[model samples]
Target: MPESFPAQTSAEAAAEPTVLARIEGVVGRLTLNRPRAINALDLQMTGLLDDALDAWEHDDAVQVVVLDGAGERGLCAGGDVRSLYDRIVAGHPDETAVFFRAEYALNARLAEYPKPIVALADGITMGGGIGLASHAAIRVVTERSKLAMPETRIGFTPDVGGTWLLAHAPGHLGEYLGVTGTTMDAADAVFCGFADHLVPSDRLDALRAALAAGGDPEATVRGFAQAPGASTVEAARAWVDETFSADTLAEVEERLRAHTDPAASRALQTMGQLAPTGMAVTFEAVRRARALPDLRAALAQEYGLVMWFGRTQPDLVEGIRAQLVDKDRDPHWSPASLDDVDPATITGAFSDEPAVPLWD
Candidate 1:
């Protein structure tokens, strides 16, 4: 039997560690504990997760690992962009890079961990949340799960190696999802390769208990898995592929305008609300990532692009401010139209080296 449960003091939830760690029989569990913030990862949380994984990797007692979040909101909402914004506004934008270095490193670590890591991707999972779940060996999503990488809507391109996942998605779905930051339902997540099993939300507890009881990892989860039903997002595949497969963002916009599908028209309308620069760069990044050899290479590429955006003081700042800080939902994006974005600038991000290399 396990020595103790990893539960917080039921009456005093506020006192619990930001990351709650414990061993449940052979399963080592790590719970993101910032329920109020929806478990948005900060550098400290990354360190905790890294430390736990490192400890569990070589421990014979830990045959499996389960990652989850506290509270009803979701697994995670991504990195605390508001905290990132404060650092940028304070002229210490480089500090933001430190967080990404650690977070990206942790992400890569989880993907390649020796032991099977099962991620319970429930509730709101987006941005960094996807980083935690999408790469896991046994990614289990519940009906309540909401997945996305909504960086573009805030004028930032998707980071957290989202391009790699997005690039590998069916047809041009990557471009559509990456550039629009559209939310994905459980079925969409499974169909797009972002997730694996569609276990019902109610069964999650029993599933976790069975895994904790030392059941075979894959077989145990599979026992509880159910079909996720048809993906509403994939239903738009024909239009998505046609509109997003164009050679350039301009071509994509033109196609979106010309396509008769109301979804296409909706996508066109959505694009109008996004940062032109973000949309352009995201399209380039997804295409670039699809050609990269592996997740680490993609991370290295993403590290470069994100650093450039952070230091250059482009749309990311305004986007965060408008959408999050000010809550105005009105971002005055520079180079307001996609036509105004400099192709050279997009290409230059790919060529530039990060001041802090990711592996370092």
Candidate 2:
């Protein structure tokens, strides 16, 4: 077990340490240690990370920071949405609001960190995971990497700076993957700009050791990034761009329905399984991010949407039940049809009424 630090407050002990921090050989490493929960960033983890990053920014000895996961399955599956849902059901919606405000602020800080940030995206990285990885200057991926922003599948649009990163993806690929929750390997991730380096999993320990030994971490990472690779996902670029070019989900669906390609058929099926409201919101968010001038503004906008979502929607709880609790692969979305999800509902999610401060 990792050595425990003195608890900041009695309430902190009631929850698990969301993150594990250590400094060795001029490298500051932060591991998302909640393995059983797939290293999801909960409230405590977000606060801990924010403090760690702020400290490291001023510590001259720490030349580089590496973010990794504790377990074999993933770096982070997503944020702890189930916890937020529980808070809502317990009639503490404000707790959910607190969670996003801190989480988004952390995302922004990482994006602008002065010191070099390297992310070891060895396995599953999605939703909140993308927020942590995409902002880093160097993102290393292994063959096991399975990266995505699968929020639409769970009745929520993507948060955690997903709006900005997804918008930065090549062409319409972002729209295709965001709506479909498509998972990709290291090669695909590198192609999509989510990863900068592709290292074999077996080589990670050696890489970490080299960094610890005062090796030029940035140079070492770049060498791996330039290693031989092919863009497998890029081959389907034309189809992805054309099919997702429609103005709305219905138009996109209509085009997909008309296409004869097997890939198009699969895309249609994936969309069919996701919540209509979630998909619509995701589509809009990505487009809006593309036009936004700054990352902070984009994250603030996401916080606005998430604040209302955690309190008002049952999709998050149902999604957690289907994906995590029971693993039943079935979710009963409240507004089952797209028609039931009116423009007003999506508009309401973007309100600034409950003015949440960006950082505490």
Give lDDT per model, in order: 0.88, 0.78
Q: Give the TM-score of candidate 1.
A: 0.95
Worst 10 residues of 1 by lDDT: 1-10
Residue-by-residue lDDT tens digits, candidate 2, 225-274: 54637765687788888888888778888888888888999999888888
Candidate 1 lDDT tens digits, 1-360: 000012233454457778988999999999999877778887888999998998898999999999999998788888878777888888988788889999899889999999999999998899988999899999999999999988887777788779999999999999999998888999999999999999998998999899999968999999999999999889999999988999999999999999999999998999999999888989999999999999999999888888888888468889887877777888899999999999998888789877778996
- Model 2 gets an lDDT of 0.78
lDDT of 1 at 111: 95
Identify the leading candidate in terms of TM-score. Answer: 1
